[model samples]
Structure formats: C-alpha cells, structure tokens
Target: MTPASLVRRSETWNFDIDAYTNPYTPPSPLHRFPPWLSRFLGYRKEQKEDVGNVLGAVWSCVGTVLGLAVIAAVFNNTASIRAHNPPALIASFGASAVLEYNAIRSPLGQPRNALLGHTISAIVGVAITKLFQLSPHFESVKWVAGAVSCGTASALMLLTGTVHPPGGASAVLAATSPEIMAMGWYFVGLVVWGTTLMLGVGLGVNNVQRRFPLYWWTPVDLRELQRRRRRDGRADVENDVQPEKIVDVVREGEEKVSLGGIRIEAWGVEVPEDLVLSKEEAMLLEVLRERLRKRGDDGVLERVPSSRPSTDCTMVLSRSGRSGSDTEVLYSVT
Candidate 1:
C-alpha cells in the first residue's frame, strides 16, 4: 500500500534534464558579487591616462564648437538657407562631431561616410515622407514611415560602405520634420553642407596631432597591417618612436644600471638530475639558454628598482680620464 505523498512524488513530471544541467552552461556573474557593489565599482579594466588624453578632449570640444558655430552662422545669416532647410544645428551633428574629432581613426568618421551617408539618408527620408503623403487616411503612418526610412537608410549605408550611425538620425529628421520634408532636395543640401563643415573642421583639428581620414574613401585595414608585420618577421613593428622594453637582467658580477621603475629579472636555467623533458621541451630550453647567454654577454642587462621615481631620465657617467666627459647623448622614447 503506497502512501499518497510517495505516489505524488513518483508521479511528478520530468522535463528536459539536459537543459537544466547543461555542461556547457556559462558561469553566471550574479553569484560572484552583489549587483549594487559591482555597479558602484564600475569598470575595473580602464586604460591608463596619457599626456594627450586631456588635450584630445579639449581638441574634440573645440572641433564640435567650431563646426556647430559655422553651421549656425550659415543658417542664421542666410534667410534663403533657412526657408528650404531644417536648422543646420541638429542633434545628429553632436554625434558626428564626436566621431570626427575624438574618434577620427574610425572608418565611419571618414569624410566619404560623413558626406555620402547623410546625403543618402536625407534622400531616403524625404522619399518615405512623400510616399506617406499618398495615404493620408492612416493617422499613424508618419511614425512608421520615419522608422522605415531610417532602417532603409542604414541598410543603404552598409551596402554603399558608408555606415555613419548619425546618418540614421538625419533620416529620422527628414521623415518626422514637416518643415524639412516640404523643402525636398534643399534639405539634402543642408545636411551635406553641415557635414562638410564638420568634415573640414575634423581634418584641420585632427591633423594637428593625429592623422584623420587616413584615406579619402577606403577604410584602413589594421588587421591587414598586423598580418603584414607578422609575415615580415616583426621588422617594422615600431614607427618613428619605438617603445622601449626596459629589461633588467642581473649578471653574475656586473654593475647595475638603474632606469627608473622598469625591470626584467635575469632568467636562470637549472636542469635537475631527476627532471625529464620531451624533444620539444628540450629544444625550447636550449634556445632559451642560448638567448640568456647572448643577453648576459651584451652587458646591457641591469636591474631597475621599482621604487625609482620617474620613467624618463638621463644617467651621466663623468669618466675622469675620458676627453668627452661632458658629451651627453639623449635617449628619449618619444
């Protein structure tokens, strides 16, 4: 005679066991830490700030201000421009300006994308608005028309290799704004002109320190460059100013050359009698040992203490007997 509880337990339905107990299930972060604490901490892996960071931000601000000012001046001073076009100072220009000046290296920030994307999106938006004019009975058709126009413009941007995200806003503006929609081709001219102004400003500002619009139309292939470097045996990895790897290898009996905080301890090789290495392991060990010997022989290896103050400095050795005792050679990373 089975009890009611036992019978009910046995009768319980079994769902997909694999789904609940999946071996490939990714670990959840919820269990690791409290969401509130994590949120408070924010990003853990932030990049270290450099000298150019503040200057770059200032430069970006200046470019945006100048670009917007030019557009505003054009629209405010010229009545004919305002009659046919939406206000030159639109919301999209802010996003465009950021990419143009700050993230000038991105493909979307290129002059071709900025100009073509806005122009095409404007045309698409106007076309969609005109299509909606035919079906005036549908009260909510305008919203749908705007969304569709933006979507189509995005697709067109991708197809044409001019995917400027801000251009979608331009499309939305064209479809939603009655004033701009009424003007037809004149609206496109406004977008082009505004974008052109920003592009010119971006070129001038970015070129001051960094190369903007690395190419006129073609997107720079960073991956291709990396691949070429790899193929070339790391020959041209460094440009005009190559980064120095301050290795501090400790020799058996040598004067320590200190260079600020940068350090790399000497790698010692010791094969124990009980130790066993495979063919590959033995070969690697041999190569490593040879490298160690070569580096040791060079006498360039020295320990740099972590407590040392600055990153850049000059060490002058006043040789008493040497004729050119005061001859100072500068070794700057930049």
Candidate 2:
C-alpha cells in the first residue's frame, strides 16, 4: 500500500488506550492548610465539625431532663413523686437515654438509624425476659431461649431498617433486669416512653444542629446490581464474559482484594497495615493521620470519612460535580 493509504487507515482506526488518566494526582500540601480567605470568612463548606455534634449532645441531655420532669408531674401521687424528687428518674433512666442517643449517632450520626433501632430493640428485650418467665415447657432452657430471642430480635432490627448499637443494650437491659421482670409485659410502657422521649429529643436537637428530618427515613446509600448483554453474533466469547464466568476468573484464586491487601503483599508498604488509601492521596492521609495521633490535633486536615461518600465521586465522568471545588479535602468512595 502507498504511504497515503497507510496514513488514512491509521486515522480511520483511532484509539486512546490510556482512557482513564486522572489529571489530579496526590493532593498538594498547601491544601491541608486552609487558604487565608476561608478562615477569615468562616465559610461552611462541610457539615462535619465539633459545632453541630457538641450542640446536638447538649440538647439531647436537656430534652431528656425535661421529659423526666414532665413524667414526674403526671405521676405526682406516687410515693417517690410525693417528695417532688425527680432526681432518681432523671439521673438514671433519662441520663441513660441521652447516652443511648449518643451511642446511636456518635462517630457517624446516621439519622434514620437511631429511632426505630432503639424502639424495636427495647421491646424485644422485654419480650425475651417475659418469654423466659413463662417457659413452662422449657423450664431448664431459659438461658438458651433468651439468647435465641436476642438473636431473633437483632435480625429483625437489621431487617426492618433500624440497627442502633445502643438498642442492643436496651434489649439486653430489659431482658436481664430484675426490675424489668417485675414490670413484665407492662415493660412495653417503658419501651413506649423511652422511644417517645428519644424521638422528641432527636427531632429537636437535630433541628438545632440543622440536620434535615428526612435524613431519618432516607438511606445514605443505595445498591444497584447491573446486568450486561453481549452482541448477538459472539456466542462462545459471550459465554466466557458472562457474569459468573468473569467472577470465576477474577476471584477463583484470590481470597482477598483490597488496596491495602495488595499493597502489603505486592508493594511492600511499611505503614500500619490498615491504611489502604489510594496511591494518589495516601500521602496526605498519612500526614493528617500522624498529625492527629502524635500531635493530639486534627490540625491541617479537618475531617475524613466523616460522612458516607457517594460512589460516583470516584469515576472520571464528563463533569465531576466537584471538579473545581475546594481541594483541601479529598473523599474515598470506592
């Protein structure tokens, strides 16, 4: 073929093999330090900080105190209520509810998680203990019954879209407590009261913290499974590339597959084994981490993984939402 024909053919079959080059590499050190402009203006770019968290905690306690006071007023005829003593109720039950709220939302305060989790769990605990008391047929198997009840309660809570960590305590509390046993199924009243009090406090406190109420019912992430179809003509090749076939090829001999898992065994990294941040931003992560652990401060890096990141953040699509946004923080969403 003539040189002109060769040139035309090469142009006709154009390809860019390296299609996924990321313009952004490891983040810059300067980004860790906020530009003077941001500090001066106090621009709130993210919701993560001590501000909302601290205030949310304080208000939850305040709400708990107020709830106990309301109860004391209603039951004024009782001997304990006669002396106008709200101390025991407020200090024990009310205080625990607040701590329980903290337990539900602390570290990562996913809103919808706390409400139903505690409510359902508290009821389960009461049920388990009550079931043990009435187990005439299984008199010697109360312990096993209680455990199975707890496990069943746990599965129910997880299945029903509420997985509050503290609620497990609530369930166990009702199941194991002598006082709870005295109350019997009447402990359902306690469950209702505690749940109502928590919901009220969470709503009020979260509002002051500027958290949207919809967050309580909305999921932070959604999972989607995709199916791909092959071209009509390629039966054999299509079979090889089917979903299960692809999985077999990739996972047949591999037991573990994570960035850190590969790094230690393949690349010989020496840092504490779990920091598997991507190659691009790993340095910045280590720097901020060391600053916090050794120097006792978050320092330059404000926050990391404080919220659930959207998986879309990792892809290099036509218009990345944060393409030109502030560079100080980088998110890991893979």
Candidate 3:
C-alpha cells in the first residue's frame, strides 16, 4: 500500500504499527565515541529524521534543493537581477517556481501566494537593508544592520499574510553586497531571475523522481470544500481554513470577551466543549447570531443544520441562539 493509503487504512485499526513493525527515532544530538573505543572499533549508526514516510522526505528535500539552488546560482552574479522592479513581472516567474515545486510535493503552494509573497518579501528585505545603507550611522555595522533589516522584513511578511522563508535569505544576500546594494531601487530584478531559475531546477529534478507525487492536483473550490465538509462525502479529504479572515476579525475587535474562553459572548446557549471553527467562521457566525437574536427573536433555541460541517455526522451550532426573537432555524449526513 502507498504511504498515504497505509496511514488511512491503519487508522481503522489500533495496533501501533509505527512502534512494533517500523519504529523510528530521530537523529540524536550526541555522537558518542569513547577514547578507547575510537582507537579501532568505531560503530556507525543511522538515525531516522524524516518521519512521515522515508520516500516522501527524500523527494521533497531534493526538490527543495533544486528549487533554491537554481535561483542562487543565476542571481548571485547577474546584472539583470535587482530590486524595485515591477511586481507582476517578478511574480510571473517567482510564483511559477514555487508552484512547480509544490506541485511535485505539496499542492497548497499555488501560483498566487507563491508568486506575490516571495518576490515582495525579498524586494522589501533588500529595500530595508538598502535604506539602512544610505545612512552613515549604519555603515560600520552593515552585517548587523542587514540582519536586523531582514528581521523587520520578516515581521512585515507575517503582517501581510505572506511568510516565505527563502525570501528573507534572498533579501539579506542582495542587501549586504556592495554591488547589489548599489543597484538601489532596481534590485527587485535579482529576486525574480534568481527565484525563477531555482524553481525551474526543482521542476526538472522532481519530475524524474518517483518518491514524490506526480505534478497533479485535484483543484478544489469553495463549493467542493462545502461538499467535502461532510463525513461520508469527504472522508479521505483534508481541510484547511484560511486564517487571514480570522486575523481581520481580531483586528476589528469582534470577539470582545472570552465566553468560556471563546472570546465571544452570547445568551441561552452553552458553547461546545471544543468549537474549533476558523477565525472567519467564528466571527461570521457570531455576527450572524447576534443580529438574529434581537429581544423578540423567536425560536431562540432552534436547530440549524451546519452550512459547512466536517466529514463527520455531528451537528455544529453554526449560528448561536438569540433571546426571544422570531425566527425558524435550520444535520447529520450519509
């Protein structure tokens, strides 16, 4: 059976196959070799680090290297690469690189985020570093200043909902070099050419490997997500809710207090023990319930089927109960 299938099928039973049949231990930090033992009898042992199936890890690492290496080699000594270039041009290639790598390994790193995120951050990092270079105060401490600049860039990336780790490295590399730093506002091109080349390398190497998944993804939309939100309908599918909406809700101060640590208040209702809705879902449902829960609201305790339930037959109180309002409310599935 395939690794994924093996995991899925194994879940139906509870024998702890990982421990009995194929136990794995991560590499230890200590490599012991006593003075007497080191004289002639040296024992070498290999530890397992990549735990989510061996084949997958190797293929992923190989792809990652190819992706990073290609850009590094090309952009490191090129005049065409620089900062402050057009975003669309940068994204066109950068996004492709990331998407191609993810296509061979994971499917989530799509063209949109991958393109905009990496290029932008890399450029921003280079910009921040360049800003510090313009001042005579930071000239003597360029390395430290550049590192700090990258940190700030990383923070900006987090705030912007785009955190690409390699982008930081790319930025620091360009900013510290006198040649790249001199490129001034035009340094964005370096990131584009470098990142795109790396992704190209990853695509070429990964396509030849079998341990990785084929460059095939079952593209999913919101309707598909809603359909799969049921147990029987999407038993094998995994779901990931976008976290940006949650951040927006928090920024807007929607959930005032933690009702049983829920950070939202309501009446005539007990919060589920483990209501793990995404930030967007929580904020939306909270708002919807409050607006519908006016004092004269009827059927305050009505059963409404979930518009987006999980792949299980359990009911989620998608909307909260209001006090004495007039309204009829809305599940298990096959």
Candidate 4:
C-alpha cells in the first residue's frame, strides 16, 4: 500500500524518469558553427559600440594609464618601515579609474565622490574586519564582516552624497582580501593616494576634451544664470516690439542680433559692423522683409549709401500706412 501510494504521488508530481536516467542532451548544431559567423548572425541584446565613444575611449585609456603609472611609481619609490605595511594598489582602484576616467560625466565619477567614498568604505571595511577579528579559516565570519562592511560603506557614501559604486568593492576588498586585511588601516591611506592620483589624471584628461565631472557639487552655472537673467530682462523690454521679428544674424563664427537698438549677443557667433550673410541667411532675411511688406500698406526695398565704403550690402526698407503716415526704418542685413 505504501509503494502504491508513493507511485501514485510521484506520478501526480509528474517526475521525469528520463531526467533521472539520462539528463544530458546533445549539443545544438549551432555549436559547430564558426564563432565570428555566429556573432554576425545571432541575436544579441547588447547594443553596438557608439561611434561617439571613440573620443571617450581614447581619453579614458590615457587617464587610466597616467593615473595608474603615477600610483605604481609612488609604490615603487616609497620605502616601507618595519612592522608597517605600505598600501598596495587594490583591484577596486581599477573600477574607480573606469568611472573617474571613462564615465567622468557621471556624478559618482566626481573627485569628491571618488575620494570620500573610497576612503569611507576602506575605513569602514578595516573597522569591521578589526571589530569582528574575521579569520580566513572561518568562511562564515569573513562573509559576515565583508557584508557588514559593504553595507555600511554603501550607506555612508549614499548619506554623504558620494555614492561611488566601486566603493562597495573597496569595502569587500578591505574586509575579505588577505593583503588588505594584513595591511590594516594602511589600506585607507592607500585608497586616498590612489584616488587623488586618478582624480588628478581625470581632471587633466577630461578638461582637455572639454568635458568631465559635468558638474562640481552643483550643476548650476552662475555665469549662464546671470546671462539668462539679463537676456530675459532685455527680452521683456523688447516684448512690445515683437522680439520674434529681431533676426538673429549669423556671420561666420559670431551670433548677434540688432533690433530696436538692443544688441543681443551670444558666443561662437558675432555680427560684425559689415557682415556678409550666407545664402540661406540672406534668403531668410528676404522672407522676413517679404512678410513685413505684406503687412504694410506700402513697402519698398531700396539700396542706400553705406556709412562704411567697403560694405555694399546695406539696404533700407520703408513701410508706411498704419495711420496714413510715413515712418523710415533703417535695417542693415548683410
């Protein structure tokens, strides 16, 4: 009765007899295919490398190389004292370099985060190891200490607004790695030194590319803010004059617009006293003049004597008849 009942229950559970006897399955035909061909044909979840990342890749490599070289040089040159171990470079520093160099635009990649997060994590890790007296022989003790250290490091970094993801790895290294554990609190100092070196490289390399640390502690640009405010103020005053009608003149590498005697200027483009507009810009100006002419009861486009003898593109346009009166408006579009 027991055997019969067991058999019935096993059948009810749908246990596979084949799985128990022979679980192994023959490899698929695809296994015989060339790897390159498979890669070309197979569906992949990962996206192709962005062409834009070429510059980033080059800079990251340079920064990583430079930063690590400096650290290695220091490590080699420094004399160690008896009974005290100088900080050896840790694996986490490699990860830190990736963020600091490769992903410099990230908040966690900033100098403050890289330095503080690693230092805090290393300290926490060392503290946990010492507090627990975690022995390598006892796997459970090591695991507990490592886990606690990692958790504390993460919490501290997050609270301090210095959440560098690699700091967790640093905690794990400090708590679990034999080399780091033996070095004791010396690991913290090492982390600081390494971080500083890497950060210096990152700053230099990233700035050279005209991008990096995208923000300091804050993303606010005070200069940009002030400029915006001033622009807004100017716009408010010109609001009655139809700010949209003010044509933005692009001349070579300058941006300037003159409307109602208010000159709006921006970087990378300047309007010279005698600027020659591009074909597209000239067409746009004509379109604007046409629109104004359509609105006017009487309008005529006439060339006038230029104050600058070299400038022949000066054109004067007069539109009359809002109230049956004539008004002369001087607009120079080159």
Return the top candidate by lDDT. Answer: 4
Worst 10 residues of 4 by lDDT: 261-270
Q: List the residue pairs that clash in candidate 4.
A: 253-269, 254-269, 254-270, 255-269, 255-270, 277-334
- lDDT by residue (240-333, candidate 3, tens digit) is 3222222221222121233453333222112344554544444454453354445225544433333222222232333334657743332001
In each prediction, how many residue pairs overlap at the backbone (N, C-alpha, C within less than 3 A)?
A: 1, 0, 28, 6
What candidate 1 gets wrong by more than 4 Å, as runs, is: 1-51, 220-334
Could you give candidate 1's per-residue lDDT for residues 227-334 as a string of tens digits? 654756533322221112221223333323222332223332233223333333433433444454467678756543433322222222122335867543222221
Ordered list by lDDT, greatest first: 4, 1, 3, 2
Candidate 2 deviant stretches above 4 angstroms: 1-64, 67-112, 136-145, 209-214, 220-334
Per-model CA lDDT versus the true structure: 0.62, 0.44, 0.45, 0.63
Models 1 onward score TM values of 0.50, 0.39, 0.38, 0.48
lDDT measured at residue 111 in model 2 versus the true structure, 0 to 100: 40
Q: Rank the candidates by TM-score, best first.
A: 1, 4, 2, 3
Residue 89 miss distance in model 2 (angstroms): 4.9
TM-score between candidate 4 and the true structure = 0.48
Question: Could you list the CA RMSD of all candidates, in the order they appear?
Answer: 22.6, 26.3, 22.8, 22.5
lDDT of 4 by residue, 1-334 (tens): 6998988887766433323322233222333577543332221234343336888788789888888888877775777622355444568888988898787767888766888899999999999889888455555678788999999999888767778999999999887888778889888888887788777676666666435554444334445555776788865654434323435432222233445432232311223545444434434444444344354324232222223232322333333325665554334444
Off by over 4 Å in 3: 1-114, 208-220, 223-334
